[model samples]
Target: MSPHSPARRRTAIGALAGTALVIPFLAAAPAQAAPCHLSGSTGSCNGTVHQPGSPGEGGGSGGNSGGGSGPVAPPAPVGLNPNQGQGFVQVPGNQAPPPPAKPATADLVAQAQAAAAFPVPIVHTAPKGKTFVRLRTSLWVDGFHVVKTQPITVGAQTVQLTGEPATVTWDLGEATRTCDNAGSEDGKACSYTYQRSSAGQPGGAYQITATIRWNVTWSCEGADCDEAGGDLGQQPMQSEATPLVVGEIQTTTGQ
Candidate 1:
C-alpha cells in the first residue's frame, strides 16, 4: 500500500492546515497601528480624526479638537466719515484777502473845504538883538523899515525906553533927515526920513515906529517935505509892516 503509513501523512497535513488558519486570524485582529487622525495635511493612523460628532455621539467631546482662529477685523472706512488726523492741507500763497479802498474824490474835496473854512490866526514874531530893537506886534501901522547902524546906542533914549527892550523908543536909530510940507492948505505932504540897517532876508516882515522931535516951519500940502515951512511939531510916525516868514530869509519854503 502507501509507502508511509497513512496516520503519519494525515498528521502532517493537519499541522499545515492549523498553522495557516492561526496566521490569518492573527493578521485580521485589528492591527496596533496609531489611532486614525488628521495630522496637518496628511492622515495618520495614530492621530485623532476630526469629525462633526453625530447627535448625542459623546456630544462632540474629543471629536474635532482643533483650535479656532481669531476674529478678522474689517478695514477702516473711507469717504466723509474718514480719519483726517494725519496731515495738513496746503493753500496757494497768492490767495490773500484784498486791501481796503482809498478815499474818494468827493471825500477829499469835503476835507479841503472844511480846512479852508477855519484858518489859523496870524501871530506876531521877531528876532532879538543888542544896539537894535524890532517891532514884532501885529498892530496896524503906517510905514515901517528894518534899520541897522555901526554905532547904535543900546541904552535908553530921550523919546523912548532904551536898551534891547521889547518895545522901541521914539528916537530910535540916528535921524538921517527931516522934511516939512509947505504952501498947501490941506497940509498933507509932510514926511520924516529914517533909515534901516539891513533889508533882512526877503520874505521876512518888518516895521518901524518912531516918535521924533521935529519943528515944522509951516503946515503944507500933499507929500511935500519942504524944509522952508514954519517950525513943525515932532510927532510919531508908524509904518505899515510887512509880514516875514522863514521863506523870506532864503525865499524858499523851509520845512
Candidate 2:
C-alpha cells in the first residue's frame, strides 16, 4: 500500500467531489427555530425572519414597505348645515316634529262665507193685498233645509261649515219686526196688523222688506271642532221690497 497509489488517488478525488457537493447543502441547512414570543397583536422571533409586507420592513415585491397605510380617511359627516360651518345637530330621538298650526277662527269663517251659496228667501205673501187686517207673511228658501253643511278649504286645511236661517226681519216701510219661527202652508209664523189703510201712504202702497239672518258654524275635517264652531256669528241677506195696498171701509148715509 503505497501512500500515493493510483487506486488510492482516484478514490481520494471521488471523495473530494462528494464532500464538495454535500458542503453546499450543509451550509444551507436551517437552524433550530426560536420560540415565538407575542407582543400585542404581533409576534417576534430571535432571528431575522420578518413578516412579509410589514410596515418599515422590506420582504415582498409590491407594497408599502416602510410606512403604514395613510391614515384611514374619516367618513364624511351627514346632514351638515351649509350656513353654519358646524357639524350636524342631532335631534332627540324621542322627540317628534310639531304639527302644522291650525288656521285662525276668522280665517275659517271667511272660508265658509266664500264657499256658502245662500240664496235670498222668497217672500210668500201677496204683494197687492189689502191692509188693516192681520196679514200673514212668510219666506221660503227653495232648496235649503233647517241645517245645511258645506266643505271649504283654507290654505292646506279642509273644514266643514253648517249654516241655518236664524231669523227673518220685516221692514214694513214704517217700522221693523223679526220672525224667529217657521211658517205653515196657510200663513206665516209672524203677521202684522195694519193700523189704518195705505191710502195715505206714498204711492198708495207700503214697501215691505224681508231680510234673512244666517247662523254659521265650522269644524276641521276629520278632526275636532275649532273656534269657528258654535255660533260663528251671523250674516244678513235681504230681498227687494214689495208693494201692498190698503183700503178703508166706506160709510154711506141716506136722507
Candidate 3:
C-alpha cells in the first residue's frame, strides 16, 4: 500500500487503450437501406423490411424496398370533346370574305347596232337615252328630211305639227350648209370635197361617221308618224338614215 502508485496507474492506462481499440470490432454494423424497385404497372408500394437490433437502426423505416409509394394524382374527367383540352385549345377564328364586286353593264346589242350602221343607211332605232345617227355625206345640206315609216323611234304613234308650229333646228356636225333638198331623192348631200374626219380603218376598211339633225313637220300618210314598227320598219321616204362605205382601202378614185 505504500505506493500502489506509478505501476498501477501505468497498468490502468494500458487497459483503457486496449478497450478503445476493441470497441469498434464488437459493435453491430449499420443497417443498409434497399434500393427502390419499380413494380407492377399500378406502381403502388406493397411493404418494407427492417433489422431488429442492428447498430444502424431506424433507417429501414424510410428505406425504399420497391414497395414504397410512388407519386400519384387524380385522373382526368371522362367523355369531353376531343377538341376541348386543358392547356391551350387552338381555334380557327370566324371571318367573312370581302363582298363580291358588281359586274359592269354590257351594251352588246347597242354596240352591235353602232358597228353595223357604221357608215351607211342611217337607221333610227329606239334607244333608252338620246339615241341618234349621224350621216356623213359628200354633199353638205342645211336641212334634214325626217319621215317615220313604222314610227321607228318614239314608238308607233302619230305626231303632227299642229297649233304652234314646232321650230326644228338642223345641226350638221360643225356647220350646216343650206341646200335645195336633202334626202335620197333630192336631199342635199355633203360637200364634194367631203372626206372622212379621221382616216379609214385598216385592212381596206373605211369607218366614217357623220351626223345631221333637223326640224321637220310631222305627219303620216296612212298612219300618223307616231304609230310605227317595233323590231323593224320600212323606209318612210328613202332611207331613215344613210351610211356609205368605200372599199377596205380604195377611194372613189379607184371604185
TM-score for each of the candidates: 0.18, 0.49, 0.21
Per-residue lDDT of candidate 1, residues 75-170 (tens digit): 777543343565643344747678655433333323332332111112122232211223221221222222211221112211111111122223
The number of residue pairs in model 1 that clash at the backbone is 42
lDDT of 3 at 138: 39
**Candidate 3 per-residue C-alpha lDDT over 2-112 given as tens digits, one digit per residue, 9 for 90 to 100:** 357888888889999999888875662332243434353322123543333222232543422334444446676686546585754555564566866422112222222
Candidate 3: regions farther than 4 A off: 1-32, 41-46, 49-96, 103-182, 185-210, 213-255
Least well predicted 10-residue stretch by lDDT in candidate 3: 124-133
**Can you write out model 2's per-residue Cα lDDT over 1-255, one digit (the tens) per residue?**
786999999999999999999998777555333234334434455444445455434444342333323234667678654445466555547576798776775576676768676666655554334554444443332323455557666555566766677788878765677777544344455666565677778899877777777787766653533543555777677877777776665769999
| Ranking of all candidate structures by their lDDT, best first | 2, 3, 1
What is the lDDT, from 0 to 100, of the residue 236 in candidate 2? 70
For candidate 1, report its TM-score: 0.18
Per-candidate local distance difference test: 0.32, 0.61, 0.33
Candidate 2 weakest lDDT stretch, 10 residues: 62-71
Q: What is the number of backbone collisions in each predicted candidate, taken in the order shown?
A: 42, 0, 38
Task: Give the winner by lDDT.
Answer: 2
